[model samples]
Target chain A: MKKSFHLFYIFIVSISIVVLPSCTKQKGCTDNTATNYDSEAEEDDGSCTYNAETDVEIHFSSMVGTESLVYNQEYTINGRKVKFTRAQFYVSEIHLHQADGDLVHLEDKYLLVHGEEHAYSIGKVASEHYHGISFSVGLDSAANHSDPSTYAADHALSSLDPNYTHWNWNSGYVFIRLEGYVDTTAAANGDADFGFFYHVGFDEFKRDIDLDISQDLVGSTAEIGLEIDFAKFFLGVDMRTENSTHSMDNMMLAEKIADNADDAISAE
Target chain B: MLTMQFQLSKNINRLTNAGVIPAFVSFFLLLSSCGKDELISDTAYNLEIPKGFPAMDIPLDNQLTVQRVALGKKLFFDNILSRDSSVSCASCHLPEYGFSDPEQFSKGVEGRSGFRQSMTLTNVAYNTLFFWDGGATSLELQLLAPIENPGEMDMNMPELIERLSNNHEYPSLFREAYDREIDPFTITRALAAYERTLISGNSRYDKYMYHEKNDALTESEKRGLEVFNSSRTNCSQCHSGFNFTSFGFENNGLYEYFADSGRARVTTLHSDVGLFKIPTLRNIGVTAPYMHDGSLTTLEQVIEHYQAGGKLHENKSPLITGFQLTTQEKTDLLNFLNSLTDYEFISQTAE
Candidate 1:
């Protein structure tokens, strides 16, 4: 009877050791919304993985009045003929306003719009009825002053060949670059001979662009169309006297251009 | 059950007594100790801090390491950081010239002139603000300016990283130093680590002041020191402390019509216009053509500018109310400035 009791005690001890470890609970992704969520997981291990799909696509169209903006193509602005050789600007801090009043913030996302590049895919977001979209025309102070070399070569703020947006000497990013030829002559009859450049950047000059539009990402990708009119960018500036500003050199002109840039953007 | 447990314990005790289990445990401990010793030896780097100077505040993430300093020194002298491979940091900041260019404006890639004179790197580790306008807040950030400046290296940071990664030796060097691939974080940290090691404190002035060696300075130098500390000259007011700099931004009246707008470029304040960071007087003898613009060719000119109360700028320091110095006093003051040169620092090679 004693031998049988001892055997029973040993069996219980062995079973308890095996079962206790299992009862401690395994760690894994516990969030149901995550693509790699484990239903059996009792504790969240912060290993949640989500789908990297393009749920929202933002398209930009650069224009001068009713005409599509073409490089080196002459366009009339404020009764003067102007031709843009280059036009580029940065967009950052994108947030999508849902119909239910929840904001889907796309953290650390930056886009550099230049030339024929028009479409950008802001990766996977929760399926909802988005009512409006808001973004900054330039990088925030923290992003502007951050080391450009830290980013990957393919990133918008990379300081790579295609995106030489940083001012190394002054230590900040050039948010907007608009360079071209303008007819600064008194008669305004000759060809666009005067070279003009407005390289706008600074923490004070970052403009917020908000567009109220309906975009539903419930079934398919939500497409947001935006148009930027270049003519409206030169509303109050006289090319003859004010044709150049490197942002820091001419604060008044840079401020004027920044304000105009804000008014120029509209939701399509 | 009690008898069975006692028998099991006896068997374990026998194994321990027989030295089988004990030997295994001893071997494991020995292996771990050896690993720890090797790690300490490999990564430990002793920075020679000169006497009287306070211990430098090193970043926790980037502790001093021999491999990292070696990598930084190599990069500092390498022209590969430039766009055309025409210039290195040592090109403008020559070691012989006290890490300052003799030219008023240091030449960069394709011999393009920079706006301001190259500041001395001697004792730069102690500095909180960098550049004449104090644009950069840290040494790591300051390094990026020269590399990307169109007048300087003109090298795109991404391209430079790619180049370094592809190089035959840099990948291994970087791996050994940082235990990671060549990136901006490691590059900047390593460079800063090496720069911090450039300590210059064993000058004649240091011996006279810190060491209590009365004879270290000559009679003229001693009199010059008295003048420097005297309220009449007020030279020590801004150029105060052991490093001989308060590091405050002041318009020493270098110019009335400010071209660069000095600290105003960073602060955008009217009062900050024409104000530049006060440079250290250490190694001032060798680092000639002084001031932010390198307009003062000699120490005599600098003293004279101060004596004349500087060119009448609205934002000039009130301490610069002109003071007269006799001819003999001027010579003594000049001699005293020469005493700050650290010959041992400039000639020493990396161990």
Candidate 2:
């Protein structure tokens, strides 16, 4: 009787291990094709086809005719003139919002773009015909403070060039960098106005800008264009003569640039 | 009797032929039903909450319960999550020093050193954002960072799930904390739920702000509040609100060449070059060596740094140009900053 009891226990345990796993296995491996965890909770009726072709592009705009460039053209820096000739910034957290409010946010939302060009694109998004596109003008809250090495990726924008965006190091990416030559022809001071740059990131208060592309798109694919008005940047400030004396070392103009978020964008 | 015995034997043989024994099948069915029936509750697990704190903002997707918090606490302290099982979250952030590592920068797995100081978790529940740069908007999302960070715990998400799922206590704990399942999201949420309960609202500054208690703070501290609120100091412009931080990034005149562009790196803008997020002043006395870069050593030096309006001038904030403060005012401000410290937070234990 004792021998039979031992066999009985072993048999039951073994059967439980084998049969139970197979029973659960019938639910199948949750492939990457399944919608996000949030959708699964809603018991996604499979009505929304997970199979879709998607493409995304990030655009940049630079000053049109201003060749030599101007610094603090918008404000004074270190009691001198400043100009912004070069600028590169980041746009991240690209999320596709469905008509039902369900969102498909990409794991890697980091995109590095320069104003000298038009846009950059993340190829073949999951939902091409997204209801609306929501993205941050800068890094999202999570990635902003995370360690740089933790964000390692083979094809990440930071990986492409370490100097441009400061990747694989401590702190987050420089969301935007503006650089250019200062117009020093009319300067009263003999300060050289060449090689001026405006580097902005975590400081600027307007780090989080939400663009509602819902109105821009007609279907799954939409060309979300943002016309950066370079003229509006230097409205109240003068960079030409100021560049002779002022430079990046003087953060006053940088603060003005940091505070100058309202004057930066428009719908092209 | 012969007919009954023959029927029973025949039935048993029939079951055996179908790849199951009668008793084995019966036990498996019973156990499976019991496992399914042992569904975890969706509500947040119970953790001890101190008085004078607000209800934590836990994500709906990840509810906290007592068992889940326990599991999260264990995971939080477990060095097994590291690549070499050497360091854990608590390694840099100890419970004793208000969760901040004593070292300015922590040593990570494989004896690698981190770049920044380990921030304290005092009154972190009310934080508008996490990390010095405000990178993670939610706690749930923030939990994934340190675990996977190459300089930190250095563990992969898949391996973490596998290890936890195999543990005897975790399967049911996962089922209890999350309904009947174990996955990455559930684990992240549970851990986040546990962290959200860390509140530091009982500081002397909090009492003075809310009540008219005259003795809540010293006279020097009160004078410090005056200087901090005064225009000459201009501290309140960025450090405003009850949280004592505007939670926005600023240049703070830390560097000129932009070794770290700070928030500008995330936004990719030229104007944000030297800026960094404004860290909260709650428990400021204990959590420093100050600034995003940990450049200043003491509160006096920090105040002095601000008094001098910082070193870098190009694109420096207009608010940061020298305050020319009197020695008395400087002393007052430092006292006020020290008053923000809350000692009770580090003492609390998991109930």
C-alpha lDDT of candidate 2 relative to the true structure: 0.62
lDDT by residue (B1-351, candidate 1, tens digit) is 344334433443443445544534533443455354233444777998777887888877678899888888888888999999999888888776778888999999999998898999988888878899888877777888888788999887667889999889899988888877787777877788788888899999999988899899999999999999999999999999878899888998878798889888876788999999999988899998998889889999999988888888899998988899999999999999999999987665433
Off by over 4 Å in 1: A1-26, A30-54, B1-42, B348-351
What is candidate 1's lDDT per residue for A14-80, written digit by digit as tens? Answer: 4433433433346789988799999988778899987543477788888989999998999988888
Per-residue error (Å), model 2, residue B53:
7.2
- The CAPRI category of model 2 is incorrect
Give the number of the best model, judged by lDDT.
1
Worst 10 residues of 1 chain B by lDDT: B1-10
i-RMSD per candidate, Å: 11.9, 11.3
